[model samples]
Target chain A: MAIESIDQTSSHLKLSNPDSTTLVIHLTDDWRTTSHLAAFENVCQGLETMPSLNKVLFDASGLTGWDSKLLTFVLKVRGWCDDRKVDLALEGLPGGVQRLLHLALAVPERQGARKDAERQPFFPRVGEKALQVYASAGEMLAFLGSACVAFGQLLKGKASFRRSDLMLFVQESGVQAFGIVSLVSILVGLIFAFIGAIQLKTFGAQIYVADLVGIAMVRVMGAVMAGIIMAGRTGANYAAQLGTMQVNEEIDALQTLGISPMEFLVLPRMMALILMMPLLCVYADIMGILGGLIVGVTMLDLNPVVYLNETKASFNMTNLWIGLIYSAMFGVIIALSGCLRGIQCGRSASAVGDATTSAVVTGIVSIIIATAILTVIFSILNV
Target chain B: MNEAEPQIVVKDLDMGYGSFILIRNLNFIVNKGDIFIIMGGSGCGKSTLLKLLVGLKEPLSGQVFYDGTSFWEAGPEEQKRIMRRFGILYQSGALWSSMTLAENVAIPLEQYTSMTRAEIQDLVSLKLALVGLAGFEDFYPSEISGGMRKRAGLARAMALDPDILFFDEPSAGLDPVSARLLDDLILELRDSLGTTFVVVTHELGSIFAIGNNSVYLDVQTRTMTASGDPNRLLAESKDPTVRAFLTRGAEGK
Candidate 1:
């Protein structure tokens, strides 16, 4: 090889003499979109002509497009040069391209051109940040809308609801929850009656414990407490079950086969809890009233007939309906938060655990907030 | 027939996980009825290359061709139509754990074809029969052996009678006997259907047995070393790495 004319294609790589200690190769072809192997072979073939070369420069000036194939070619050439102790310099690459090459090739270099250029922050880049905001809000809103739609469409699928899944959710959310709800509601009612007894005794009206417990249980406390407990238990269960399935690629497999995972997984759980929670809340109310009755009979020396009569007189239909509405709202929030966490879970077993914890936390927080808001509204409306 | 009419052609493919390049400039073609194997060392982007071929991931750059038509050039409906002509058997079989064997086989049939329940069941049974699992329709994936699950995956892959099938490491975790059995099944499929296959594997037994043509990836260089009939390459290649890899197992024997 002898001296040849040196030509400048661009600032990146200038074609120089083959005999010179330095040679530059510029890959300004459709190597990424064209036949990748042929494009790669072209570079290899072009470089093979140089028998003696100490240093070489690579310019990606006209490399309008590139891909993994082209990257592999560059890496291959780098290896070849390395084997022969040739120092290859790269220039005029885009920052993104330079970053990718550095990461892929595991090589780092800096030049004056790239130093002063301001690049966007990795986290706050408009694309992913916008998606994060949109995704979080969208995921929350999406569960509400999609869960409702999927609930209606569940029965239309080829796999009819296995009576087992329904029975399982019921047994878990209803039968298992009964003892806890009853115990808590009774304690709450007794606490209310004890306080009312002490206050009413000051005015010689201690028998009003019957009125206090009856109104409170039927109006708010019974439903709100039951809803909160269910939010912790059933909502967390839904998230853990579906989140595990999602991480294991079961949800993706369903989508590929045109089965909506929402319909397959979430709708049944949501519908079962929604249909069951209010009834459970009503049961809690009855148990709470019994606790109040015990307190009134023991503490205030009120007779059973008189206590029952005061309870019946004080319990209004509007109060009962208020409890029902609040329980229903709590059910929706629990189901929504659970399903959202489940579907949005990351692809790992640990993520399933995280989703379960998140579901419980979100479910409990939302229920408490919702109960407080509804209680205020009910008081303002005198319901 | 035009010699250029490949069943699938990948041109200048670049795929990565957002700034980390996995495979770059991967170009290869599978002619009609050809058994093309992509071989590389572990983590040399074989699986990523398979994903790009099947449209699971968008390449950072480059194009894939099926029958001379650009894959990305097609509309969604057209891409779906093209998808119907091919099938995929993922590394782990990727079968639906919740579904029974019969239901798994019926997925593509039920989704792409307008077959009634009876017709779908019949087709599912036929596919299962072809994969030597005619009587195991009611068994869930967990209840079956690994070999049986791979067979079921194959049955599902072939449900629509696709002209092309792609498998990502068909014998990865199998016992030698089971892997050999699967390899025999692959040969049987190729012989009977004349379907084009694109497999990504470094299994020498499979490469020697069924690979009509192959591409070898050099891990150190991160590019293709050689591509041709493996037997010929084994006999005539001048590349040191290619020779070393191909002969390493032989040296052990």
Candidate 2:
């Protein structure tokens, strides 16, 4: 055995015995994160020339010390060997380190640790998405059907729900929602008057800004504005509350205790929203008319009494009824989507967040769609 | 060169919330390679003191030194650098809920090191394996059991190869078998790596098994009332409170 046969280096690590079938990397560094890192640069360089080598091992019982740095480097080497189908082992290492290595390697990498999820072609992906939508729609219908059944039980005075819970939800979806509703309504009214005044002033019809604002507030903007606000505020809140309960397994616990979650939870929230929505629409309309009055009095140089008279003239019974009816429809859609998302929430914190976001998106999209359809029908009927 | 100096030193430390001092006049030294424990009853501000030591909270008065450099007196960049050396395991594991375990470990390495993705991935798997979570890189924190989350938290703590690890109730929610395994892992890491540990726990098994030095924080007095080796303190402590606490209220028996 020639003494010079085993190659060594000035640094604490080296690649040795390149000519032999086995490859040996030696470690002599007092490995640490602070002072020195196990760079393994030399050994990595040597592996390039050792083409026929099939075995690898570590001799790390140098002079001083070691830590996870050394272990990390060794694990990297182990990974390299595994890829190349080489036998690797640890020798002449401390007992503690050897034991740690044993424990680390004790459990084989778990099955499905690296799932190479197959990528489908575009058409297949589109088909899958359509199928998913169909399944979701079916689930939604089933959920609404069950909710109606619970509502029937409630009407018969046999549902297991607390009136106080319904009242609390009503307060949350209505009274607590007043600030945002007022804010959005006022802004929308201001925007309407400003846009209308810009065009009306060209035709000396600037005073008609009040009529435009009042008519829009009572006809379409009131319900749509309130619907969007509630979607962001109360709808998101409902989904988050349900999602958290789902995450905590409270819904599961309720079911385990022989309680119907739909009857006890969903019914109350739905009733609260349905009961408060039309009232909120009326309040929103008043706020919006007040906003238009501010714009008319400030920007249009119109008298307050004249603006009020114009608003009164623009108000029609059919427009008011349609606005209230649309708000009621919005309430149902928002409540249904929020409660459905909550009930179907996955058991994770991120899932709760996603449910809340999905609730808002679903609520807003449905409101917009219903508005378009309602407006088209009303125009055809000349109402 | 660093062997003669203490790894950590706490001097005249005062901890509390806004003006209410929780623990005052705290002083201690953790020699290199020591498993120094900070023990107290619940609500005694054990976690608060830990925050102060780890530079998370400002002390009302006092100083903490790492390798004789006062942590509070250091510049912002120096303080940040000091903080990077710490491996803190909070009571709840505190793993990022959104990321998978592998991604959780990879974040620190990615931020601090200039390693390639392949190298970072290999290190991530190795760290997970060290915590007995080898095959669980793709699993999110919520999908795993509580014990597994704790283990994964430990894996993340060791991701950057910290010099000193601070644990808040490492064995709090673990079962007996898992707790013992954690204790064993802690001991083995200490022995093999010479990494210092400053753990906050009241679990007697862990205290006796791994702690070579410790300080007792009194709940009633809101002060650290005792300091020394735990075994020697148990046998020779004259204070009834210290004796009761050390013997776990079985002192007379």
Candidate 3:
């Protein structure tokens, strides 16, 4: 028997045949993970060149150092040999590499464990998304029903939630949020006055800036700005808090203790928002008018007294009532969406984040939809 | 028994959250290749002690030394160099919910190593396969079982081939079979890799199964009541609290 060296093409690897039925892989040089090593395909190519290969042996006498990269290459070779029922000798490898290989292969993979990345066809994906949307709608409806039941219980004074929690939620969603609401409402009013003055001044109808800002602020802009602010701020907070509680199994704890999470958690938040929205809307209206007055006096060159008089004369009770109604509806929509998303959140950190984002989106979308419906109704009723 | 060099030494460690001391004057030594258990009754600050050991929280007053270098006293770069050698498996697995299992395991390797993307992928598969999660590379943390998630966490922790691994309540939510398997895996890893383990758990099964050395924190006294081999402590310790805990309160009765 003659051992003849065959391939010394790659510096890190060599191939030889001791017998026609056996192939010996000669590993050389540093095979550290950070260092470049011969590709697994080189070994495979060597195996292919030998037709009657029944055994694979390693000659690592030339190998200076090795790490996981060497082991990975060996494993790939082992897998290839296993598929062909060929003998693979590990005795020539380092002791540490042998031990790691043994440990890695000790446990057989569970059947059907791997989730293959199967991209569904377009129609199936669309159908799956539709099904998910349907399921979500069902969950939202059920949550809304539960909320209604909790409100009913409250009317009968039988709801089982702490008064302190209610008070705390009221303080959070109301008093703590005033600064942001005021700032946004005033800015909205000022922008409205500036745009109106620009257009009205072209026709020398600058005094009509007071009419435009006054009517728009009282009719819709004030309530809409406040609603958007609360949706992003308080609505997201509600979702995050409840989603975390859900993650920690606090909701389950309440259920185990014969407490309704609806009453204990959702009721307080809803009540607080509903109670505060109209008040916040009214404050926003005043602030918006004040902002418009600033523009009217400085930008429009109108007297402050005349601008205030014009605003008062332009504003009617109908517009004020409509704005309050919009805020009240927005409060319900925001609180419901936030609470619903939170309660329906999956038990994971990222799920809480997704819940917060969904809460804000759902709140804002529902508010706009509600405003559109209410505006159409008020117009038809000639209010 | 031959005394191996101390891998971690805690001296006069005081741990608490502002004015309320949970455990004070805690001292212990974890030898190289030892599976050191931190055990106590509920609310005894076992997790907090694990936090201190892993550099998550600073000790109120004392020192944590790893291989003779003080952890808290080390410069930021020095501390990071030390921390890079540690692998911590938090309770509940704590896998990033947004990432698939493969991504979670590959992050540390990608951050710390100059390995190519293919090498990183191969290592990720190897690590995952080591923990019996070979084929579950694409699954997210939320998609797996609790036990599987823990194993994935273990795989990610082992990504850097850390010298020391810390586990917080490794068997907290596992079934009996799963918990036993986890215990076996820990023992096998320690035996094969000679990786030191610091585990916080009150599970009597685990404490007796894998622990070669242990420390018991007493909630009532707010201090470490016992330290040494758990089996030996069960036999020879004179403290009633230690006896009661090891016997699951049967000795007190």
Candidate 4:
């Protein structure tokens, strides 16, 4: 009887050659998952030393306690034995371990069901990402086309959506957003006046700080800041709301009920933001100019009346109209980006989160790009 | 067999949200290894009862006992310890959308056990294999079909090998064959591992196929109308409501 033993701190295993065709595995001690256990490789080494083993029997009578760790080791051995066409006898093991092994191995894994999680080469991954971006651009164009069609239907008085929903969205995106708009606009105006006052003070042109704050706030800063706020706040909210609806299959239900989601869902949101943007920009401009007055009176020691008169002189219809135009365009960009990303959201919780993030990013990036293009056009026109 | 030991006991349990009581004075006993079914018509608080039993929602009054310890009255630490021994399968197979099937099954084991990464992977594979999903480990929940997702959810539920499993509408959205296959799996798991099951379903085929014990909730009365073996209830129940529910599939078949 030639026997080989492999002992670990928490478990023990012994391999014995009872006959040339049969092998016996003796297991002892606690084989709990938290305990250090004997490795299955030792059994493989022992089997390699033996000649023409046809049967393997487990003797776990010395086991004090066991859990899934022991089961895992035995299963590995059983799999190895199965590949080698060796019979595995479990009658010598404990009753619980035997039953558990039988249960776990009862259902064989389906072939071709597992997917390999291999990483692609760097170039292929880059190519895949580029293709995805191109495809998404096409999807965005399609979504914009549908939005135009919905707007056309609205002009023709044939658009089908709840008027109440539009009213609710108007309240949500317009009046409810005033507190944040006021806070951001005032802070931006204060910073602009502070910077302009320092420069103008060196030239004894402190009065020009009023003109600087007024013209900047009216021309671009007011609209840009409001657009950014809406992008992060209302735009993200739009994406999350619609994305959740997509996840819950509410959009599908709407389609099944023969209602156009573009008309019923997207249109109301776009209209609300479009109608609110110009008005919000005007309100933000007033708040910004008021902030400039505060800085002029407190920091620059300018009379409040003088600051107001200088600000009034800086005002003109062209700059006001240009800023309004920017606000309107930004409103459209924010709404379209938010709704497009939301509509394209995949059906998962993480997909909704991605859609929300993408909406804010797309909204902000396009807003800046549109501002740059519009500013260049206005400067060339000398308006 | 010997006298079956009680695994879960509900006494004078009242479940509801706010002031509206949905189920009142509910009492039942789930013995060890019993495939217990909670059945009722639509809108009869079957799922609510499940929520109460699983510690997701508090009972309005009275007690829920697991192995003779009161669940609601227990401290938070004790409640968490007791809850750790439960496995729940939601109606929609609510798998984590961000993780693959392997990761989903591996989470509970990682959180609760000190097993090495390799051992956890082995246990994850075994659990997935038990639910007939051995090869689909790398796939995400959204990548699979509805039936496959349910099976994957079952694999995750069984990852920690809980003593009690709570299933909410296991066959709600599955086709007939897939539903029957799941029923068979439940039966096999119960027979082999002796895990207690509390299944909330109205599907008659599943109710009769796997449930050896059950409690029927009544919507109008806001309480349980019957409690016993599902087969025995079907054969001997005299309550017309219970009779109607049990024989619902008879007319369709």
Candidate 5:
């Protein structure tokens, strides 16, 4: 009879000899990951000395934990002793261990064997592998191309928005956004005019204060700042709206019905944003200039005629066009990022949130990057 | 004597993702105007097989022919042309949530046809009527119940009066009443329109009610073990997995 104490801390082994046979074998369930293969291999080698030992009982009840690689070693040892016609009886397999053994039914024994098998790879041959790589690359390229084409289709359908959908987006995205943009633009202009007046008075050149605020607000600052704010506000909203639809299977529903999700979903939103951005930029321009005019007329004690004339003269068609174009670019970028992220979203609530966050981040980053690049390019090209 | 060509022919189909082989050598045919159900447990490639049949996901190895034309092997435009003949009711019905019932149904009409708004509206109403959701045209998907949403989706799918209709778990995620109603609708559509139907589901009630023919996918072997009438297969099949699944309801009782 083989009796053993079930120690809670130290390791314990239980060897049950089912058959009547005299066998000498070292049995230890103190199976650490480090000593796993060595201990199992030592048991196999020790069996070589006992010729009469046709049966060996190895118990694993006391081993609280073991990794896959260690269990794999035990299976290999079992296989080795099995081939020698030695009945290696494994006793006290934990319930968890039994489940794991059933789970990973197939695994390689030797590293060399795995290496040899991996060297001459199966499943997908070289040609098929190359084809798969090419196919995936082609798929990615096709997706990008489709995205561009989708954007183009949206642009072409700029005039094709359903009166209702366009109006809804306009009311929600543009009209609702106006109050925020106007308030911010006015505050920005006030801050700039105040700063310019204070700095210019020290140089006794306070007259130029009106000109500085006028040129900056009308030319670039108002439109660019407004665009950035919209990118965060309305842009993120577009992404969230469409992204939610994508995750919720609405977009897929459209596709299944022989309707293009992009054409139906993105085109309408893009059209609305495109039409709204330029109008919003113009509104911001007016508000920003008006804010600065208040400071110039009251605080700076400047004549309305002089200030108005300077504001008119300091800004021109070129500056106006630059602001318009960049703001439009920013608007397009926002819509593009939002819709793209939305379509690319995975099927989970978290994925929709991720898309919304990425849409805002990408929209803002792209706007800044494009603005900087366009600034340098426009300056160099004298646009 | 119906002598029309088989609506769908899947020969030696192998569908899967990456290194994980989902199913292999799946061969079956759906006769014209037949209601065919594909039944299997969860994660048994039932959806993937449905995708392949509808030409949504290409098979890793094999061909799926729709009305004798290899839809996937054909060019994109040709594929779209072939796709026009088949209507699909995706699982969850996948109706356009933003659009109202009428607009959602009119989407296909708006896309591939030059049908006037009046004509499209008439067609939409007709489809809605067929699915028992008549006069609910202005209702947004969110405004309706799940049963109505599924009916709305069915209305949308039937917009083109397609020759073949594919239902991905049509009765899934529905109450017994709604599921039975959906099954009845499937039979009604087959009776009235004579359209071929392919449904992917494990609902035994729907299977018994609607399936004129079917295929059972075994998870262990990762292949179709039986393809025929459910009643015969359940009573006669020797495969334990097939028996386990088929008699699952009996076991519960």
Candidate 6:
């Protein structure tokens, strides 16, 4: 009998080849992962030498412990036997273990199961991403141009989006934004007054803090701060909401129903933000002046009347108009960034999250760039 | 598995969100190893019913019991313990998109058990193979086909080897062949493992193929208008709505 050439591990696995036709592997009492896999691999190598072996009957009657280690070993043995076209069977393994093994090997590896794409060079990857951004910018510009057309149609009383939807967007972009706008604008005004007080105190001109805060807030700080807040709040909200609808195929459904997404979705948001930004800037201007008045009265012990007169004297009509104009421009950019990212969102949940993040970033960056350009233009015009 | 003891029982159930009662006065018992189905037309709250049963949404009234334990009445801790025994396959395959398929299936095991990484990996491979996704261990959900995603979802559901499995529209959006493969896989698991199934679907072919006990929810009436075997209902029920649904609006031969 071929059982003479037996490989044995007292506490682990044992292979007893009783004949050329059958190899009876007697698994020991311990087959846990701690037993390691060398004893099992010995069986696999043993099968390579047994060219006459036609069947494998694993007698696990004496096995007291089993885990994934044992199953891993068993699957390998099964594969080796399969390669040689030998019959392999588990005679007395536990029912759960047997079922698990059967289930694991029930389905063969599916053809073409994994798609492994080759990695691109660093330059190519960067170039591809740059090209994507360029393409996205073009799409965003096209959307903005169409939104302008929709605005002209609305002026002529011919735009077709639901009036209620426009009202809702106004409430969303205007009223819902007030709490955050007031909070940010007041804080910036206080900060400006404090910083100006520190410098003005050296010359015994602390009342000029009101002049500094009022001029800065009305000309730039108030609108820029409120614009950044809206970009993070309502702009990101628009992107996420539309991105989710895109994920759910609602945008596709709307198109199939013969509705223009630009007219129905983008125009309303753009117009609402555009119309609301100037009004919000006016409120912010007043709030910032009050904030400066708070610091000038309390921190510097200046009379409220004196601070108010200084703030009034700092205001110029052209600077106020330019600030409102900048606020409206920032609003258009924020609306376009949010809506464009949403309309171009990929059809997935994670894609929606990405769109929201990109919208916030794009809106804030565009606001900063526009702020710099407007400052240069105002200084050139001697405002 | 005790044949005499019912695995789940819903008594006088009323399911809805907030004040809107979608279905009321519901009653059902899912005996051990039975393929119990909740069938209805679109917007009939079949998925909502599944949510209430799975504890995703609270019932407007009444209670659901799992193996003599009240799901709603249990303390939060006890309810979580009971819910651990349930495995649900969502309609969209709700796989974590950021993770690989193997990682998705291993999550429940890692959460509930102290299995080692290698052990969990082995079980992940086994589970994926069970649903014909043997070599798709490292692929993300986006790379896979819709039909394959459903099967992978099934694999993730079965990862914990739970006593009861819940499937929501498993065959929806799948081609007929993939759909039949899923039905066959469901039948195979039920037959071999004696696992109880509660499926929500409107596909008639899937119903007659795998459903042994079903309740039909009529949208017009907004209640369970019919219950029992689908085939017998098709033959004997005189309710035109039930007949129309069972036959899928086709004239009976």
Best-matching candidate per lDDT: 3
Docking quality (DockQ) for each candidate? 0.13, 0.01, 0.02, 0.02, 0.42, 0.02
lDDT string for model 1 (A287-312, tens) is 88898888888878889899899899
Measured with C-alpha atoms, the lDDT of residue B190 in candidate 3 is 87
TM-score of each: 0.66, 0.59, 0.63, 0.61, 0.77, 0.56
| Comparing 2 and 3 on DockQ, the stronger one | 3
**lDDT, model 2, position A278:** 92
Which residue runs of candidate 6 sit more than 4 Å off their true CA positions? A2-12, A15-25, A29-57, A64-72, A79-108, A117-124, B1-253
Candidate 3 residues lying further than 4 Å off, grouped into runs, are: A6-8, B1-253
Query: Ranking by lDDT, best first?
Result: 3, 4, 2, 6, 1, 5
Candidate whose TM-score is highest: 5
Give interface RMSD, every candidate, in order. 3.7, 17.3, 15.0, 15.0, 2.6, 15.1
Clashes of each: 6, 1, 0, 1, 0, 0
Q: List the candidate 2 regions with Cα displacement exceeding 4 Å.
A: A3-10, A34-45, A61-63, A82-85, A117-127, B1-253
Query: Ten-residue segment with the worst summed lDDT in candidate 1 chain B?
Result: B244-253
**Model 2, range A1-383, lDDT digits (tens) per residue?**
42223443646676566446776666676776666553566566666567788888666657378778767777878777889888887775667677888889986775544777889999999999999999999999999899998889899987876566787899999899999899889988888888898899999998889889988999989999999988888889889988887775456433422346788678888889888999999999999999888989999889999999989988899999999999999998899899999989997989999999999999999999999999999999999
TM-score of chain B of each: 0.92, 0.96, 0.97, 0.96, 0.94, 0.96
Clashing pairs in model 2, backbone N/Cα/C closer than 3 A: A110-B135
Q: What is the CAPRI rating of model 1's predicted complex?
A: incorrect
lDDT of 3 by residue, A1-383 (tens): 68787764488888888899998888888988888777788668778888888999988998999988898899999999999999999999888889999999986774545898899999999999999999989988899999999999999998867676789889998999899988988888899999999899999998888889889988898889889999999999999988987785445434422347798789999999999999899999999988998999988899999998989899999999999999988999999999999988998999999999999999999988888999899999998
lDDT of 3 by residue, B1-253 (tens): 2579899999999989877677899888999999999998887899889878887678889999999999999996677788788888878676655469998787677657899989999999999998889999999888999889988988988888889999999999888988898899899888888899999998998999999999999877889989999999999999998999999989942
In candidate 3, residue A109 scores what lDDT? 75
Worst 10-residue lDDT window for candidate 6 chain B reads B90-99
Clashing pairs in 6: none
DockQ of 4: 0.02
Candidate 1 per-residue lDDT, tens place, B89-157, comes to 877677877679998888777667888989999989998988789899999998998778888888888
- In candidate 1 the C-alpha lDDT for residue A219 amounts to 81
How do the residues A111-136 of candidate 4 rate in per-residue lDDT, one tens digit apiece? 54478788999999999999999998
- Candidate 2, backbone clash total: 1
For model 1, which pairs clash? A68-B14, A68-B24, A68-B25, A69-B24, A69-B25, A70-B25
